[model samples]
Target: MPSYTCSTCEREFSHCASLQNHVKVHDNAVVDRALQKISEER
Candidate 1:
């Protein structure tokens, strides 16, 4: 799994999919957006 760092929540996730679900907490829009952006690029 790849390492993903979410600055919005200051937590690291093992993968982008996990990070996407985690962003639901604290409504971390930045992290969610980052994940989406990365996904779109890929």
Candidate 2:
């Protein structure tokens, strides 16, 4: 099993697949869009 550390959750995961799926929950497109909006607002 491969180990991965999620940057968003800061939790250690043992498998790559579970870690990938877990990361998606935090990777909302809206969040990314919001960041872009914030940057553009600056």
Candidate 3:
């Protein structure tokens, strides 16, 4: 069986859709952190 692996977290998923969703979660988290940093800087 083939598995999708996350580059950022080294997690594995059984399907591409699950991997994509997982990556989006990480992307959102990074965006949230950046927004928080900007807010802190102000």
RMSD of each: 10.9, 4.3, 0.6
lDDT of 3 at 10: 97
The TM-scores, one per candidate, come to 0.50, 0.54, 0.92
The per-residue C-alpha lDDT of model 3 at residue 40 equals 100
Question: Backbone collision count in every prediction?
Answer: 0, 0, 0
Compared with the true structure, all predictions reach lDDT values of 0.81, 0.85, 0.96
Q: For candidate 3, write residues 1-42 as lDDT tens digits.
A: 899999999999999999998999899999999999999999
The Cα error of candidate 3 at residue 10, in Å, is 0.6
- Best model per TM-score: 3
Candidate 1 local lDDT, 1-42, one digit each (tens): 579877676899988988788877757666788899999999
Q: Which stretches of candidate 1 lie over 4 Å from their true place?
A: 28-42
Instruction: Tell me the deviation in Å of residue 32 in model 1.
Output: 18
Prediction 3 global C-alpha lDDT = 0.96
Alpha-carbon deviation at 37 in model 1, angstroms: 31
lDDT for model 2, please.
Answer: 0.85
Which rank order by lDDT, best down to worst? 3, 2, 1
Candidate 2 weakest ten by summed lDDT: 21-30
Assess the local accuracy of residue 39 in candidate 3 as a C-alpha lDDT between 0 and 100: 100
Clashing pairs in 2: none
